[model samples]
Target: MKKKAIVLLGNKGKKYEYTRHNFGWLVGDLLSEKMDLFFRNEYTYSFAEKRIDEGFIYIVKPMTFMNLSGQPLKLFVKHKKIELENILVICDDVDLDFGRMKMRPFGGTGGHNGLASIVREVGTNQFPRLRLGIGRGKYGMVDHVLGTFSKPEKELLPSLLSKATDAIRDFFILDWQELMLKYNTKVSV
Candidate 1:
């Protein structure tokens, strides 16, 4: 089995927590808890790893913040000797409605700063990614992404995050194509 990396992208600090932009970290938090893993901090990021069967799953949270995620990610990949195909990035997307998600085996950044940094540093948009939607409401893109969840959204958030984590856990067991087919549809939560 190949060693795989799951990169959960988000900014650091309490100020960013619960904001729309921190969705990736939120998912990572839930995943860590579910897996009973603890992230060990490095200068650029924090990461937890678990060995399974003949492979390993590395969960990475970039502490370099969101925009500079690529620097730490690039270093991690090289250090772990993980192939690009084995890497999966998770992040928030503004295009899809809130609570909806989309996964791609490989694609462009789609205007995400963290993703763009990853693409630039990794030198390709050919890696797999799971995008959790944080839809743009009436507010400007900056405001909407930076703001915390609305009351209604907060009510529904736990289920959404749990589902996202489930999809992530599925990544290791199922083939990427099958996982996409199963998760890319309308997910009611």
Candidate 2:
């Protein structure tokens, strides 16, 4: 069987930690824990790999900052010889409501810089993605994505993170379409 990889993009500095933009990192961290994997610096990012029943799963936290995430990602993909369909990107979505997740097979960046970088480097927006909603309101779209979550938002974060992690695991067992139908929702699990 072939190995499957998932690349997660997020900022590198401490200032970006816990911010809404780091939601992808948050999910990656949680998933790493659940899978008993630890990240190491490699290919311009912090990455971890684990062998699951189906194949190897890789979690990447890009060190190239948000806007230039695709460079490292493309390198990793080519070096590992993994196909685009085997890659699932997790990112924060401003357009989605808080706690909601959208599983897309392929689409535009939807105004996400990290995603935009990926599309640019890969020359297409045809890979699958799992988008986590951080909510948009008083903080405005820009501030909301770059800002830290509120106390209430933090309270609901763990559950949502767990669900997103599960959704990714489900991707290993089911195709993106099936996983989206079962797990995509506004409610927190």
Candidate 3:
């Protein structure tokens, strides 16, 4: 059976639970609940795995800080022997509007430190990624990415995450082209 991984990027700890940068962790929580999967703490990450048809899908959250996310991923991929193409990274994108997402087969980091680390550690930009929009707010870039969501954005978060998880589940079942065609859009929520 094939093995695939969904690498969710976010900082660990309760303090960051509701922050914009922790969006990937929030989505992972929702996806875990929907799939009835529980994460197990590893040395450098937390992960949950489930069998789907003839394959296994591993949902991973790197325990390292957001900027060092790729460190855990590099180790995990080496240990699991999972190919780069079979790993899908999910992360927040400050440039996009809230409720929007872009799914790409390969791309540059777009100034996201987490993605930059991944490209550096993994030695390539040729990996699938799902960029969730967190809309740059009035604050500076660092503050905005690390800040909490506004009232209205918090209200719409659930719907956006639901669509994101839907796309994640599809990643294991559908081809990359098909998943991109179906999920790359600005949701009007």
Candidate 4:
């Protein structure tokens, strides 16, 4: 069977740009550039598709605001007939240190509203997820999530994003166990 996956971006518009919440979108932008796919707005989401040798990859940025991300996600999944295992939700995580990443086959929302929306829409948390860490700031959790990356964090983003893009590719090329062993950790940025 063809291996298919949907990569989700977490926020929308100028208001949320560069905020920690948009890290998933940033990663998707990088990958889209690398893959040479340009997104076009459709069905309340911005999306692009690329067909690689193995299967198809879909990159999605839900126009739905952060708290209601699941609407477009569920619509896309159902419209495309994609299985939960084939979907990989990418979002920012405050709990991890900046520049770190974690991948899990299934889990709870980890207190992220976007994730909670997804869990609610899907009716299960069995899908894979790529959690990109945007460490907390001095102000506190809310402030940190709402804030953009600092100068140092901005400097580190490309390398971290590169690693993340590679992880996504690895999900296609290698088995889950191998990919997890190779990539689930902090890497030098």
Candidate 5:
């Protein structure tokens, strides 16, 4: 079976924990814990792996800061010998409303620094990606992304993250087209 990679675009350090910029990491961390996949610090990521059928799923959290997310990702993919097509990058998107998500087979970076870095490092924007919504309001982009979830959002984040986790699992069990048809929308879980 082909080895697949699920790269959760995020940064390290407790200071960034639970921030909107690192929410993708929360989903990866939660899903890994729930699936009993323990992560170990290796190379430039907090890496976890699990075997499903004849294939393997590698869940990774890049240790580098957000804008430079791809540097570590490029290294990790090369080390694993996984092709760009066989990977999905899960990241936060400020264009959609909070809790919403969208998936694309490939496209331009949409002004996202982390994605821009990934596109540059991987030498292509033709990789699959799942972007979680983190919409901007009256606040500036930096404030919106660096800010914490609201009171209601704090309560909602766990389930949302869990649903996102399920989405990752579905990436393996179901076809990519099916997964996108079902999950690529602004609807709540």
Candidate 6:
């Protein structure tokens, strides 16, 4: 099936709004604002919908904790009747440098509890994903992922967020492989 929906992996509470762990969620929020879509709580997620040339592209932020993100997603896909292959997950990756990103057609979660949960629930890791770089923290991995951005990172976020939003918009118009190739190596200014 063609990729048709987007699942942004992030925590939901206001406490997590600006935290590194919330990159994917923040992107979803930004995209919603830009597109004038308001997400409503439903079927275990904060969900919104938009119709492009092809069909409805869902914007979902799982209401569950990051580690259990899949619960909502599993419910979401069943509710929307969307196949796992037709969804794209956007998540933060501590493995890459800030401002850098990678897009993959399918892969392991690389220890991300959120991705792992989704994989287990969905019974596959073959779905598309966009991993936004947050860089490894000198403090600690756990601390890093939970912490808010630094001054420099905060300064750079607008540009990064813009690029990410654009990439997601492309998800509706381009094939997964083509979107991955176009975004994987491109660093945001």
Give the Cα lDDT of each candidate: 0.90, 0.86, 0.91, 0.84, 0.85, 0.88
The TM-score measured for candidate 2 stands at 0.95
How close is every model to the real structure, measured as TM-score?
0.96, 0.95, 0.96, 0.94, 0.94, 0.94
Candidate 5, which segments miss by more than 4 Å at Cα? Answer: none
| Tens digits of lDDT, candidate 6, 1-189 | 232678999887888889999999888888999989988988688899987765678889999889999999999988888978778899999888999888778999999999999989989998989899999989899889999999999999999999999988787678867887788885848
Off by over 4 Å in 4: 1-3
Model 2 misses residue 84 by how many Å? 0.4
Instruction: Pick out the ten consecutive residues of candidate 6 with the lowest summed lDDT.
Output: 1-10
- Candidate 6 local accuracy as lDDT? 0.88
- The reply for model 3, stretches above 4 Å from the true place, is none
How would you encode candidate 2's per-residue C-alpha lDDT over 67-160 as one tens digit per residue?
9999998988888788898889999988898989989888899889999999999898999899988777684677877888899998999999
**lDDT (Cα) of model 3:** 0.91
Instruction: In model 3, state the lDDT of residue 128.
Output: 94
Tens-digit per-residue lDDT, 65-153, candidate 5 = 98998998899989989988888899988887887887777888889888999999989999988899878856788887888787877
- Candidate 6 lDDT score at position 50: 81
lDDT of 3 by residue, 21-67 (tens): 99999999999999899999888999999997888889999999999
**What stretches of model 2 exceed 4 Å from their correct place?**
none
Report clash pairs, candidate 4.
none
> Model 1: which ten-residue window has the lowest total lDDT?
168-177
- Name the Cα RMSD for model 5: 1.3
Q: What would the per-residue lDDT of candidate 1 be over residues 1-189, giving only the tens digit for each residue? A: 669988999888999898999998899989999999999998688999999889899999989879999999999999889999898899999998897899888998989999999999999999999999888889699999989999998998999999998888787779877998988976788
